[model samples]
Target: MRRSLAALAALLVAFSALTVGRADAADAVITDFGVQAGESDRVQTVALQRAIDETSAGGGGRLTVPEGEFRTGALDLKAGVELHLAEGAVLLGSDDIADFPIRQTRIEGKVQPWVPAVLNAKGLSGVRVTGPGTLDGDGKPYWTAFWKRRAENRKCTNLEVHRPRLMYFESCDDVEVIDLNLRNSGFWNLHVYKCAGVRIEGVSIRAPHGDPPRITGDDQPWDEVSIDRAPSSDGIDVDSCQSVVIRDCVISVGDDCIALKGTKGPRAMEDEASPPVENILIEGCDFQSGHGVMTCGSEATIVRNVVVRDCKVGPGVPVCRLKLRPDTPQRYENLLFDGLTLDGAQSLFDVKPWRQFYDPQGMAPPKSEVRNVVLRNITGSLRSLGDLRGNRGDSIENVTLSNIELITDRGDLRVGEVVGLRYVGVVINGDEIEAPDSE
Candidate 1:
């Protein structure tokens, strides 16, 4: 029989070199389904998440976390799983907060509940978490109870400090998280919700060196006070859901590196609940220590086709921010911030809306709107600057600032509108005003 078909093609090339070869799915090996290397096993991450929930309930595989040191706690990834963290693996995170527990997740989206994730993959479909190991969220007791409630209530609620997140994939589909490092987390450090064909490549998220915590009720008294302590730390929080593609990632944060959300309102457009975030694509990324390198909505609801191209922003954050929350039926349409490199900032763009200590008791306060925003080719330089307020009653209309070359030290450019508008390329303190062309 042709030597039994050449010994079945040499046993499929020795079972493809004992797993872990080229890709295209088909790698189902998990160190014999229990993974181990150098001790500290919480039964080896619960026997490798029960062998990836019994091989994705008999229809999937590939959940290997080889290499070493895996002091586990919360690692739940199912649905045709594919979490391979070989090459010196680490997966540590057990600073014990009940070793993590608090289900029904979905942050920034309107599920209003979280907790559970030191790497979680939910309601999946072809989910993946490639190699180049390390998913450590050993956040020193939730960064010491978020600085003891920011030294005693200066306004707190990151779920009242019970942090735990270093990878949270929700309502997923065809997801792929490549080359990882994802470190020090106790909250918000790669949280994607209601996903679809999402791909986050070459990741490297870090955290350490805490010294920021002030958050004191907003509504402009210097708007955002403190709250930058890499504690409830967020560095990639895409909510609602969409066809996402965040390329070559690298974020240094204590808050907001990329936050575009949706789904929060009178049940947020009810379509049987959920679904609002739209086609998002954040190109080649780079940001350092949070506060808007790319942020939108305060708790978004209808964000549109967002495309932030070739990026890089550093030093004293805030290159472009629009946190509208006049209660919460937000809408930031067709946003496109092209080829950017604002190497320093304090504000290049900021739209307002946050009705003082906002309260949408039963929803119906948010009438927030910011239309066709496009900040093309931007370069930067700014210090001790802030405020580009627009909301004399739901403002920020059809903004288009092209070839932005900023250099501000409060060098004025504070234009406020609301009376049949038309404002363009404004420059204050160096005057170049040309607004008032509307009838």
Candidate 2:
């Protein structure tokens, strides 16, 4: 156990952020339970589930999946069981929606009946999913179906088409997800909801990158076709979760790379189930080709005390993005982004209203507030500078940018209705704007 903790510190971080499950010993192996390594029309998850159940039912330990290409439906991860995939192992999600049973899970900020993720965990503690392996969500079919639905109605929500994420942990504590290649997710790659003391480290998340072709025929082999923008395929969605440390992850996804989410509605601020997301630290991560490197909401109500530091943003990504919902009452404060090195990004800061698939439930729209936000020590070159705008009744106060040096392609910066905004040692496009000049 001492050796295991030492190794974990080396792999995840030099300083330990959180302590997870004890999975040093393997008590069961999936292949030992007559599980084959290929495709089948029937749900192949039965053997795997049996192994997990037997191992966890008795005193819990690690359950190993050996090196092979295994296909399965949805699976439930029990408490005290660590699903460790060996090197060269590949766990593929079945394309059949029927294989995934409908379960009550959170999607897009609401808890409703949806397809469970490839791996699900609920109301458990000391859970860990780690190993140098791959979890592939054969997601092209879902993407094709989503585009088709959008074409017909143009207003269909993401939940209209059932898509499964790679992994989902709900109401779990002391979780650690590390050292896995999670790709081609039908929806968000990793969704952590209401889970505390979570540490996500050294995982690689990739989504479809091909150019999206037009959806002309339903009978066409949509799976074989190319779709660059995977619908709702965010890399990491931390929903109403706290005490999370996301470090050393490499993310290149179609949607936002790291998005903070909470419930969204006129009365979202009063929603007890979806509490405020606070005390998060995101550090030493790499982002590429995502919508926003570090973003907050299309479905956030209250999020505070978040710090993103020492991250790198590749080209075509926005460093910071805030999606303020006009229909929901939001309070996002005490957020800080520091020591970010960006290269050729789209913009430094992008904050605007997000109204897609927004329904007010016929109630009066509520106002939002953003305060005590800071972005410091950010060195980057971006296409455009920023567009930070607030809603008419919204309040944005006490925002500061310090030690920022950047060369911009276009100096089109727009700021509106911000009180107590300040900049220190900021240079944009060879122009310096210090304390008194940038008030």
Candidate 3:
């Protein structure tokens, strides 16, 4: 184990050296471009873009935003550029949809038309966003729009509603996002798509707690809506990415704190020839008030070799989740969750079929598979042991639970369609189920 940790550390060091070595020598401050804080009608978008473009044109360097609230629209990032926000700096997103131009991007594993994010970096290398500052998405308008749309159509999907994300990085290499407070996103907070050698550290993401904002169209005030009205406010979503490391982050949002996904179905299968998401490492994180601490797949083609360790999940946060949609072809394997302390979660491990948006688009339904999952050294207070249900002839296989202690009201371990299930030193309320019943 020691040797394995050493090797991992060495690999991280090598990756950092390779990526950080490409940054330029000097820093370019945005304030030098006549950006001010006190003006009511001022939008820092143009000024910030000027700084980034000039820096990139002059051989990429750091574009620094000093301490102030700078309202901005979509700011496209360039290669070899680092966006640094100083302490007390707040990069506020404009609520107007016009500020975000429509672009072709990947959402839910398919390429489609979508509003560009507040900060977008595509096809870039050695890009970084680091600072103790904040990126506030100001998502109230978009959230209201989504609720109204849902009211009209009860079965509307996420893509049907138009909203912009906080930060979106696509097809980028050697990306690093560190020490930033990302809050109140209109959609997913941080989305890293089809990126490699990514490292996200010391980030804090939070959405509005309590109730969703109320719609004021029918004699109602917007701020009084129930918190449940907030939709798709995910914390960090890593989609079709490789060699990713996320550590020391505190996340609490309306949706999953950390979600991993791949291609949706036949379209993704035709585009890619290999696994979509692989070699992901998540450690030393705190999760609170989310759908799940870590969830895999509503649309995944192949996700393999993921490790989650040393995480603390607050009350009502599921430790881990695996979601398989019948319409999407998926293969999830070699996932490990170790040293997790969970509290008041609905379940410790949740594996079930997802049927929220079940449109296969006339394609033949494909068989999904989940195999080789390990849960070790987990201590938690959960509502139940959890459920593992899979389709017939496509069973979940080789799941091992070791050194687990849980205090729960109900210890019923629902093992449905699982093969080679093993439990070692597992105790639930001072009683061991011994052999879990499998169907």
Candidate 4:
């Protein structure tokens, strides 16, 4: 028996060595390529790309960005490489649109021709971006351009405005982004598309808080504007990804804090059988300001086994939201929200059919299904209890709520086209609502 145990230990050590051997070949430094700060010609982009390429070519290793402001365009990350940004370092994005070249990428759940992100990684494995510094997207120019276009066309969709994301990882596996401050993005801050085993922890994603500053080229001054000028600047968007764990992050942006979406458009849906986004866990996150702390789809095909717990959401944001667009075929099920503490949020739960940019293209609107949701141990002060109104041919099913204590002046629970709802020990405004009829 002792000899057998020794043999098992030897096998375990060999497996661990093999795993580590596949990743780190050697440690490479970025300073070897003359990547220094305060260059007169701003040739940091070329230097950085050369560093990444050389490191990848010489067998992957760690590419360390030392303490300085490195302004660059789109830098593609490679497999078995770790981009480590040290303290006092800042990776600044170039303001020129020419920096980010156009590529065939996924945007808003549909694969289309769009500009790549400032930092992009695709089809790689064992990639990591760890930092104690910041990634600042110089988004003022993009914001000014978008507002100008909006002034010309008041009814413009998000697609109409051509903006680049801050960081995007596509079809990458075993990714880790930790302890970084990603701020002031042109569009969506961090987007993970068609990836697996992604873990984002201890990160802060922020856009401009209030009204945008007045630029010299813009005619209008966006002073005291109530609406967000940074349109569609979502904090983190997980699109058609699986096995994602986002925890210990502070997200405050103009759009949803975290959203999940699947393949969109009829053509994409018919041609490709994209996998559903499942097994997502978001916990221990602090949401300062956003649309919703956790939102699921205006373009999802199937989203299942999602849990958002142990999160604190600040004022003026919804705790949880599920958007069902009638034009997109979707199914959202097995979602759980627990141990959430809200401070004067707009609503506790919001599940409704979203009609923004709904184009059926001469076809009948598709129906959606939302089922098997459970919300428990929620203590909050909200304005409303929220709505659960499905579309005409669709309905919500098997929703359960328990141990919810909320203080709201109007406990308006609008339940329409719902089936098999169970409420237990729910207290709102000093009244216990044991059943659905008690409301």
Candidate 5:
């Protein structure tokens, strides 16, 4: 919601001030190419791929997907072509992993030979996919298999199982995906890697959250069993990208609502494949529930210049979560969270060293830094303000909190290894905790 009309008017003014389009990218229809509606055959895949290829070869236009359930395998979206889903259309992913061909693509932090996404665009300049419709991942089978494998081996990575994402853009520029409902992704919902000038707007991304019921492999009833979580179903993963704008999105998923990532470890410093993720603007979005509203790094080296403003967040969403990995030399700086309204969450600022599976490969724990951050003009109620603790020899520097009025239900805010943590016009409950010398 933009809130009540009066509040919405104010929000619109704020939204317009906060700062962050589609072209006529559908000219042709998939059904026109003899694609039968509601068909899951290889014929559907061929027809769709042929349509995309022919459209691109014909100097680029939009290939429209009309109203129907069209199941297909991996699709390589090429230059100068757009996949436009009509109002009632559904581009469903196939259940068989064999349908998605394995390619040398970037997954998580590493670039390896993995399955291509349901819709993949690589090494192109102009890529687009718009929808008032849906891109369904149909991911229950993948979810069940991943959960089963994790049961056997406690040390299973996300890509160890063959799971395909809904959409992936890699090594491309000027990408746009707008107004699409992306749901139930086998891995991440929308992933952009090593790309620039990307715009993702008005998208609704969702997967199951919490211990919701799941259909087991035994063909159990949907409501009979409960799984822990949708394993690694992140909403949007912006890995090593720059100059991106994500606006007016509604996201709720099993993992992070939106994450900023890069390559991990000291080796990533000289690695040219994955660069730092920077110059991002996120505004006017709604994060219903996830691990965090915006998280930086479980795998990262440098993430900078991110601004998240004018968003509405529901419960169980950390406002800003920074996962500082001891094994990786991470530097997260120049982040700003402003003009937000939140219902309730566990932490408003949750920054802790992520030591899960800490393998530095004989390298010592590298020094990391989180600096030049600000959180202001936020009105919210949460369990705690946050737990901000940098590791030993690491630094959390120059964080400013201003006009942040919150009603916290939990214990006091924790702080350590922080330098120049400033507070201005801050009100918690009925008390005003202002520094004597404010900067």
Candidate 6:
């Protein structure tokens, strides 16, 4: 048979030339002696920190940020470095927030403060920030000093507004951020605390859509329009770490594209009964910025097997968000959102128990809990007016809905209590939404 198909095409070209020579021998080409493109940000941050401390003093590799605009100021990634940014590169920053200082670390995941960011990395193990270039923080005066410290304390937290986090990985393990494109930040673009085997692939995050990044001289043009909700400028903030995986990304930020938090306020149930953020996985993503693409608790602490399937949501954010925080004894059970597709959102399954921005004399009244959730095969054509409220002493239980096809303008579904809801073969608006054969 033609010599067995030419020996299986020469063994797939010798395994693609040994996987491109082991990725060019684990890479380390810092523009051949560093600091080149329109130089002198103090000589390219001192020749890129002397080629990342001489490639971690001869051990680790992959630092290559080749292409263009490379301004600097604060960049301290090491321990087997990996910051590859080719293809029209631009790792610009240095709008000077005292060049990002003040670090004790672990912001959302309680450790008493953190600030040093503009790309900070600690305890890294095989770290990586892949290409398709652009990690610009350049955050308009740290988002105008974080809304002037929330116009002076709107129950401050998120480390009292001392910004800078477009990427901050600490206690890292096999971490990987692939196909990058992160923009305008001052806070939360990606802040994986207490990391584990993490992988955020095919990324493309862009902030500011529909007025939220304005706190300019507040004279009430609606208070100078401060829509950039400066409290976790989210796109990704999965704190209290675990084995995470966010795939096929394309987020549009103003806040929450993926937010499951933990650790804060009155000791967050001893940090959720000891490091409890289980196997999380989000699939085929695409949400044009801000508000629930896969959320849980406003400051989540105990989350379990979360799996969000094939997604693609667009138009005026605010869909499928479960941010129940009645004071924080958090627990969200094995959640799952399967094959989803919503175009033009304004609402669709928003479970709320968020204590109106909690601050009951410094919090302590939330015995948080969201049970086994599952929303299967949902196909929406929504436009607005939706609400699936829950919180009459907590219980958004074993929610299961199969083959759902909704066409909304507001109607077809709304319940906070249907004994924790469930429906198979639900086809709203075409009529067929039943599920009570037993709980």
Give the runs in model 4 whose Cα sits over 4 Å from its true position: 1-25, 40-43, 211-228, 266-273, 435-439
The predicted structure with the larger TM-score, 1 or 2, is 2
Q: For candidate 3, lDDT tens digit of each residue in 1-439?
A: 3344445456446544533433445787887766776652466788888888888888887888888788888999986678999999889899888888888987877678888899999999887999899999888888877877676666888988788899999999989999999988889899989899898999999987556444535555544554443588888888989999898999988788999977665455656723578778888999877888879876677887778889988877777688877777778877778899888877877888887767778987777888888788999798887788865555588888889998999888787888788889899998775747688
Q: For residues 1-439, could you state the per-residue lDDT of candidate 1 as single tens digits?
A: 2342244335334323332222454566566665665676453667767777887787675767778877877888876667888888888888877877777776655565557878788787767888798888877667766666655675765677888888888887778888888887888888888877677777878776357644433333332233334575677888877767777788887778788776554345553445677767777788766778778756776777667778887777876688766556566766767777766666766666554345667655545666666666665666633554544356566655555556666654455653323334544335544544322
Estimated TM-score for each candidate:
0.32, 0.92, 0.92, 0.89, 0.90, 0.33
**Residue 102 in candidate 3, Cα distance off native in Å:** 0.6
Candidate 3 structure lDDT = 0.81
Q: Residue pairs in steric clash, candidate 4?
A: none
Of candidates 5 and 4, the better by lDDT: 5
Q: So what's the TM-score on candidate 5?
A: 0.90
Q: What lDDT score belongs to each candidate, Candidate 1 first?
A: 0.68, 0.83, 0.81, 0.80, 0.82, 0.70
Arrange candidates by TM-score, highest first: which order?
2, 3, 5, 4, 6, 1
lDDT of 2 by residue, 54-145 (tens): 88887778788788778888999986788988898888898888889998899888898999999999999988898799999988888888
Q: Sort the candidates on lDDT, descending order.
A: 2, 5, 3, 4, 6, 1
Q: Residue 241 of model 4: what lDDT?
A: 89
Better of 3 and 4 by lDDT: 3
lDDT of 4: 0.80
**Tens digit per residue, CA lDDT, model 5, 1-439:** 1122234234335434432244554488887777787665443678889888888888778889988789988999977888899998989999889889888988879988999889998899878899999999888888877776765566887778999999999899888898899988888899999998888999999888667443335444543344546778889999999878899999989889999999887677777887899878898999998889899977878887787889998887898899988788888988888899989876778998888667889887888999888888998788888778777778888888888888888636677778878888888887888533311
- lDDT tens per residue, model 6, 219-281: 634434445444456888877778787888999887788887776454677653237766767
Please give the lDDT score at residue 181 for candidate 2.
Answer: 92
Model 3 TM-score (2 dp): 0.92
What are the root-mean-square deviations of the candidates from the true structure over C-alphas? 20.9, 5.5, 3.2, 6.9, 5.6, 19.4
lDDT, model 4, position 152: 67
